[model samples]
Target: MKKQTHTVLKNVFGYENFRPLQEEIINRTIDGKDSFVLMPTGGGKSICFQIPALVFDGITIVVSPLISLMKDQVQALKSNGIKADFFNSSISPQEENEVINRAIKGDLQLLYLSPEKLISVRNTWLKQLNIKLVAIDEAHCVSMWGHDFRPEYTQLKVFRNSLPQVPFMALTATADKSARKDIEEQLGLTNSKLFISSFDRKNLSIEVRGQVQKKKKLQEIVNFIERRKNESGIIYCLSRKNTEEVTSYLKAEGHSVAFYHAGMNHEEREKTQTDFINDDTKIIVATIAFGMGIDKSNVRFVIHYNLPKNLEGYYQEIGRAGRDGLPSETLLYYNMRDFVLYSQFADGGANSVMQKEKLNRMLQFAEAKSCRRKILLSYFGEHLTDNCGNCDVCENPPKDFEGTILTQKALSGIARMGQTDGITMLINVLRGSNNADIHTKQYFNLKTYGIGKDVSFFDWRDYVIQMANQGLIEIMYAESSALKITPIGWEVLKGDKTIRLTVPTSPSDKKKQQKVAKITTGNDTNKDLFTELKKIRYAISKEEKVPAYIIFNDKSLKLMASQLPVTENEFLAISGVGMNKMEKYGEEFMQVIRKFKSVSKPRKTPTTDKTFILYKEGLSATEIAEKRSLSITTIFSHLSQLYSEGKEVELEKYVTKEIVDKVRIAFNKLDRKVELKPIYEKLNEEVSYGEIRLSVTLILKNE
Candidate 1:
């Protein structure tokens, strides 16, 4: 099974080997066992079921959540020479019938469906077919505890019960402990084997910025995007108005941009999505309604104009970048106002308490003083022993100083003020303000009242927020927006514990602190060659009516430029090349490489002598020399000069074929593109430098 899987990996999918747990999951499913897989997006979850579908004797039914996802997956599978199709609302009646008939006849190896369609058709064509395995994608949606819950998914249990003998596999990218348990219970998975891959995308560099003024923030975003010109990206805003404004601003700046929201008509939204997927638009300023199941693999960045509502949503949004295993980036801009806005929205929901808790956790992540990756992974129930150096915090770490005195002052103020006020009031009390509330409460008479008066209001506020994020103080949202001191704060006040807080640096200062390393490639790499190769790829993609990455991703093109493969075997050795791709497009690409190699060879200028001109006119060199009143030896020199210049010369008239063959052998024995001295020495200096040069030039020209 392992050997067969490897064969399928190379020959069909063009991959070299299985990702971490793909083989184990495939083996379990082939043995007819229930499996629950929780791997991140772009983590090769499709291969787990696709491999077993090819290995099993019957067809596999994959339940997808979105029509677009189904279409993309089916197209990708067909491109890899797999027998796959999808049955969804987007397809015509005749098309659906053809797919159903194919499935009934066992002509298709894999079939895709939505939960609503699958459950509704349980007793219809689905029950009659020989179903081998049932694979549920986006399985977290079945759990009400999941972030993106769909009520129709709850009916899948009934559909699962009807096919009790077949193995069931549920897969998702993001799921917490509670959601995982709910998924298992809701899906009715009995004795299922669980496979949880790490949720770390090492290629994505995560960065968060506290919101500045609107103009400054917009300029910052523009600068970020300018660095990644002509690349596809997604900019997520919190509202339709923001999306429109951002899209307009970027468009005014000459960027290819579009906006998407629920307020638009169906046709408008479809057009926007289609344009983005086809790379006609470089950026999409969209709300949360967009990008649930988007399958575009070359997105280079994902920027949040505002903070997301939860860790799950943020993680899933950032997962859209770098899907092609290339370097990508994610930027999140957040502030206290966004948190307040989210809190207000949560207050009106049914699960207000849970929503607020989730929002608070997200806030803590944004204000974290340590590695952002650590905080993000820990939220998904994975612990990291070391800091991931890819994120902003790890790259430009905040300055740490002894903040015990500051922490004690803030804690004493909160404690002495009766813990019945929010951050503003607490900061006011610390600064000894003369406001009406302070006078009414007589809060200025406390021992800790004016202790922090030397610090400005904004500075005190930032320090207090930092303390809250570090768990020295807790924000009691349900208790009239009061602040409560924790045990750690008490310890700090009593001088029993020391506290260290990170000083907030300005954005410009932080930017100056970052030092990027340079990347070097092989000597064969040429920028002009890479551009020419890209032109070929773009032409092929246009002809096929597919995105450029579908033919060959940017990483594959870079490898092609660096290695410069010129033969079938060498082209196949490139990373993304498989048997199918090599057979389909190998010869065309190799032709380009061969032509480039021939044109790039160093050549001397053509000779300009009248003797050479006469020789080229079909006159003998001796005759030309005699006609021109010059010596025969001089004409021979002129002939050697013409041959060395890579021009056509009658080499047989001067040197015999045997001598030319010996010189060619000597040149071949030495390294390619070497000077003539090495070949002369290797030939024992029997041939003169001029004759040797002429013979080498003729041999190279023939090659």
Candidate 2:
């Protein structure tokens, strides 16, 4: 006669019906059945355990990995009106005692403990309380082969054996065949029932954007963020310094952004989390150190500024977005250097057996030809009805070619060239180059030398990358890009196997071959029109002391170009010009709008939702559409729905003409000024030079 969990779901959780698989898992857990929950990030994985714990007679123990995650879950649980707490070294002995007392006194339904904390001296006998359920989140960490492995996860098996009567569950977003098996074994849940939801997210478009230079790559990211303005999003950088660098860059660009990493003080990290959660900020540039339980739902996009260590890490990170069941996006910025670095870490060391396997799985995943989404689903033993056409590969499939002969020649050439020469030198030899090295080695006339004259250096390099991915050509980074043939490669070169490779397409060709982007402003030479409008918007922002986006968004600015509303009444008709802004500073901005309106003659409604999210959250619908794997029209449709439903406030609070002018002036002066630090620092204090710079950049780069 436990007061029905479904009732709690409807009343407190506010869900009339649990999404598929939720109730089954919850009921099983409440019945003390050990469970293996495989729900995706936003799939209500926590509900399965949180709900069951509500009905259980004892406190439910949640074993988490990171301090951030533990805190996030506890906070979310409290928000849901559930009694939940977490124990970590962050608290003093007195605080620990209070938490323990709460659990023992039946005042808490859920208690989150980091795996490291549980195995610590202070918490050794912690579980001696009336614990009924033990939920291990990010369960794949227990597997030595998972992306984020912890040695302490192995000790979870001991906890299960010690607390045998209590039910246990483990959850993760991305675990392939081997990692899943290892997690089950390591968690001592071999006999437990498994509950797996679909791994593929139809709305999440996956893609690897390759070969773009750093400046262009960053510009692409900025533009993407600008296109979708103020929705919440996370940008992942691979290194600690990079996290800080990106955070600084975005902040300088005029977005309210913050950084988080293992290198940061715990307090600073906590504050960053708070800023992001409270909506004081919308963008978080962080290292992998940030996720795993850091619950800030409604994140619209997750971009990997640097490639993730592995697909498991990539999957879990991207899973953070669209957790509220709305469309979200996932973009991974990949470079071959990232793979090489991760590979070097794999040759033994203290690397867990599972970490090694997961690393290999990620390698396999990167090389996968079938739909990226399909491979992910199939790995978890789920079947896909058809190819997921949401990934970059699916959207623009690299042209296919019969590389059987070329691959054979490359492998033979590498062996003959002594595994010491890098792909470049090897390729040169294959294509019959008589460079200094070849002339000095007296090897220019070899049979393979110059045989590949027909192949361009770029295409030949692409061939090498594909070969490295195929395991036919193993990369040797220790000695300057050397390509060594593997055992399988020997079999292939010996004509024992069929080797077909997909050539990596050149993104530049498509980009360059396209027509110049057409900007629909009212005047081309009167570029001064948009510039003048920006100056007015900047001026008002300075007086108001807010981000320029608060005054007039790109859409509104574009609308002003078309409508030219000189009066407040007419300006109000232009979208984004509501009552609040009209009262505050509408007269000045409306005048600027009127100046531009005389030319465009109101052809169509130019104000739009596309760049609105960008000005707010730095999301691009195309990127969003691509990241979420949804149709362009469908993403736009959801966006329109969201925009209409969201609260509409005044525009003047966020933007003005003075600040935009200042930012424009600052950029114009940077090259001329001897030192940049002083100018940028001064700008950060006013109209937030950091945020303005990023916006200005997006406008210039995309235009």
Candidate 3:
């Protein structure tokens, strides 16, 4: 099994190492045992099934919910030179049939199909195939208690009944106690291997900040990205409107960006996806609809402009970064509004018991403070011996005050009330305060009215959430109110481990790095030119559904105004221009160029000037390279973006073939070898003294 697995790993996947449990999981599966793996998103979950699938005696049919995810997996597998294919709605029937045929003939190692399709008669393609393993991915989706519960997942149980002989591996990134039970039940894996990887992504530093107004928060994000410019990353927003707004916010700040959401047409979403994969877009401001199949590994950061629905979603979303085993930042902009809004999504369902449990768990995750990594890991039944010295808490170490007395009083107040009111009413009761309404409720409780005078209601509420986050308190939330204390909280009140608690600062008070949301101006003609170009770009942008600058970046705009390309051909010849973009967007820009030429103000060729392509103020050479597919040497050959008139320098010494042609253009007819001043003056024309020096160098260097 080792030799076969190693062969597949190297010859097919080309990976020299197996991520943690991957080799063991594969070896177990290849030995023909049922396995259930719970690996976090960045844990190389694919390899668990993929390795076993490749080396197994027959086909391994992987059941997944996301079509895009299947495509991503298939593409990655194919790139590794492994035989993998997907049959989904996106594929033609003929193609699907071919893939099915290949599976039946045992020519394929892994076949990914949607759960909805796998149960269909036509896709009973699996019926005739000798399937070695049935791997159910996102297995928690089968449980109503899971964050992304899909009803179709329940059918996996029925499918399992049909093929009682086949081994099943149920896999998911998330599941608490309830969800874990549901996965085992739904998949009918009563006696399967349960391999749960710790849900701790120590490499990912999770920092949640809020109460910095949305615009300022966006600017903060911009500042963060600016510091990390040129790195790959994602920024998630809650709504399509927010996605567009955030994308605009970032692009207005001059970031290379793309936006994605369900509101977009399939084509638009596909285009954004393609652009991201092809490296045309460095940052994607998107809703949760994106990242289903995103396999790009070098994503150095993932920022959430809005809170996600649950910890599972948050975990998966943030997990998209640092996949390449590098340090990446996960910035979550959290607020109460997000929590309340997302609760509505999990609001109504037939499975009330499971739904209530799942929602409360998510709430706990958001409000957590002490060893956030430990709590997240413990959810998957993995214990951490020492604090993960990576998450926000371990880095800063929150202030731990004794909240034992406070907890007992809060619990006593709830007992006296005889029923559950929300946190607000409960806090009010414990503080021993009386409004007209409070007096109506028996003029105060017997034992605990205002008993909590030592603690503010706000601070006490913070203690409740922190206790809940650490599993010390539990919320008996449902259609009916039942606020019950958990066993841990009871033990603390009964003189246990002293209730030593480290409370997190109010998310509202945490200092977010501030940013100037509004773009300031330099109060110059270039600034005016930049403004005008942005307007023109905005108009074109509405039609293209792209950010304004993707068409003509700020540096490109500066290049156009400073170079003042007077003709259509010259406009096309400007850097970052191709024939298609030039024809469509160039007329309005041409007017600006013509307008600038008429004023006859001496134009300062920007660092991106065709004759000065090697140096620039605003853009790096990589960005220029990405914008235009031309190589570094070719771009350097077209330079005039760097030369100045009064600066005295010898052209022969600094000059290479890279700039020789452009250098030859600036020499004057008299060729007197004066300073570079003559050349800068005649730059708009064909000849200047600087140009003659190149001809002199061609002879002087040779002699």
Candidate 4:
């Protein structure tokens, strides 16, 4: 059975191997048992049941909530030579009957229907078919604890009783533990095995920016979009009006963007979605109503223009990007105003308490000082022990410095001034201001006067706030908003305790923080080849009337460009290339690859070679990173790649022997060809990613 599943996986799905837990779930379901899958979006949840459907003799019934989702999956499945179709309102009655007829004749392997449609057809239409497996996509909708609760999904339990012999599999991308339990109970999967894959989408870099003025936020968005021109992205807004406003702003800035919202008519919404899927539209500024059913895998970025109401919704929304397993970016702009508005929106509902609680967690994530990915994964009950270096916090941590002297000066000024003034008055006293209030109070008589005279007034305010936050002082709001010293504050003043304060980010620092590392090909030739392949994919998509990704995702095209596959045999070896696709679109793509490879010359001085030269000059990785303005992780990754190419790199100097042994043990236990993340986790995350890379390179070098 496992071999059959693997065969089907390779021949039908074009995947060389199963993702973690996918094979186990598929085998359990094939053995006529129930399984509940809690995998992240783009984590191969479809293949769990789709492969079993092909392996089973009878057809599989997949209950999906959105027509767009059903259509997307069915289109991709049919393109792979699998007989699949969807039954929804989007299809005519004749087409629905035709699908039913095909299913009855055993000509179709998978049939998709929405929850409402399935319930409606349960008595009249479902009894006529031989259903082998029942798979529910977006199974979270069945649970009230889920972010997207649909009452119709509650009626889907009827399938368990009606098709008692058929195995059931429920899947969702963003369900917390509560939602997971509720889904099982609601779906009557009492004896089902639950599988939760890692929620970390390593390809998506998470970031959050807050406290910017409205104009500046818009300008930042414009700047972000400008850098990734022609790449697809989405900007989620809090309201329909905000969506239209952002869309207009982007358009005025000369972008191929559009707005999508519930308020837009169906035709308008479909056209916008179609344009986006076809790559004719580069950006979609929309409210939360836009991305649930979208299966477009090439979304390069996702921007939350306003704060999301809850972490579940936010996670699923950001999951829309990098679905093709390539690097993507997710930026969230939030403020207190968005929190207040969402709080009000969550009020008076039955789940109001839960909603507000989730919103609070979301806000905490936006305001978090730790790794943003850790906070997000922990919210979904996936604890990441190591800080993912891909997030904004890990990349650009706070500049902490020993601020004992700074705190002592402010505390001494506050005590000498009788501890009776507000923050502004304290600042004035410390900076030796000659203001009327300070002079009238004769605060200049304080011995600590002019102690902080060299410090700027703005810097003093920041220091005072930090002191209050650190419990070194208190802001007595009830006592006429006076600044009072706490016991901890006295200890600092008396030199008993030391404290560290982070340097506040200035406007220029904020601009520097907005820069993201671009995902690039190895050289100019690979990039040109990739561009040509995308054109071919888009042309085929136009001719076939499907999303370009349904033909071949950007990941596949990238691999084609990098490997320069110009023959059918070589093209078939590419990922996402089944024999069906190889037979259909292979020649055209091969033609492009052949022409590009024929004309392209060998490159000189690749990016990694530059790093090698710098390494040879005796500069440390940190020093090189500082000089190049690149992250230290990137520098290490470059060196690791150079080592992989058999270059003379002393990669051992970057990692300790203890780390090398741990990584070696982890790699030997797991699939060695897998990415670095699984190995990082297998080592219990005690090793940093850079350390893991260096250790793995050393292990392979020794082997």
Top candidate (lDDT): 4
Looking at model 4, the pairs that clash are: none
Model 2 error, position 600 (Å): 27
> Pick by TM-score: which candidate is best?
1
Summarize candidate 3's per-residue lDDT along 78-144 as a digit string, tens digits.
5444688988789998997898789888888888889888878434557788888888988988987
| Local accuracy of candidate 2 as per-residue lDDT tens digits, 1-703 | 2336654564335344677888888888877788888877767788888888877877888888778667666654554446888898788999999987887788888988888877773245564678888889988888766666788889878778877788888887767777888999888884688788877676665666654557888877777777667767899987888888877777778877888888877688877876676556788898887766466655778998865666667777888876645456677776666666666666556664555566666656665556788777766678888877667667667667777889888887887778888766887898887789999876686678888889977678777878877778777665665778899999988998877777666443233212112222345634566567767876765564443444555456656655566643345455544333544556677666665566655535333444344435756556765665533333433443333445232222333656656765776667533222334445753443223433353334334
Whole-model Cα lDDT of every candidate shown, in order? 0.80, 0.68, 0.67, 0.84
lDDT of 2 at 331: 71
Q: Against the correct fold, how does model 2 do in TM-score? A: 0.63
Candidate 2 RMSD computed on C-alpha atoms after optimal superposition onto the true structure: 16.9
User: What 10-residue stretch in candidate 4 is worst by lDDT?
Assistant: 507-516
The regions of model 1 sitting more than 4 angstroms off are 404-460, 476-499, 507-528, 599-703
What C-alpha lDDT does candidate 3 achieve relative to the native structure?
0.67
What lDDT score goes with residue 223 in model 3?
76
Cα RMSD, each candidate: 14.4, 16.9, 15.3, 15.2
Show model 4 residue runs off by greater than 4 Å.
401-500, 506-519, 601-703
Q: Candidates sorted by TM-score, descending order? A: 1, 4, 2, 3
Model 1 clashing residue pairs (backbone)? none
How close is every model to the real structure, measured as TM-score?
A: 0.77, 0.63, 0.59, 0.75
* Candidate 4 residue lDDT tens string, 604-676: 5556778888999999999987887654655777888888888888887888888788888898888685355
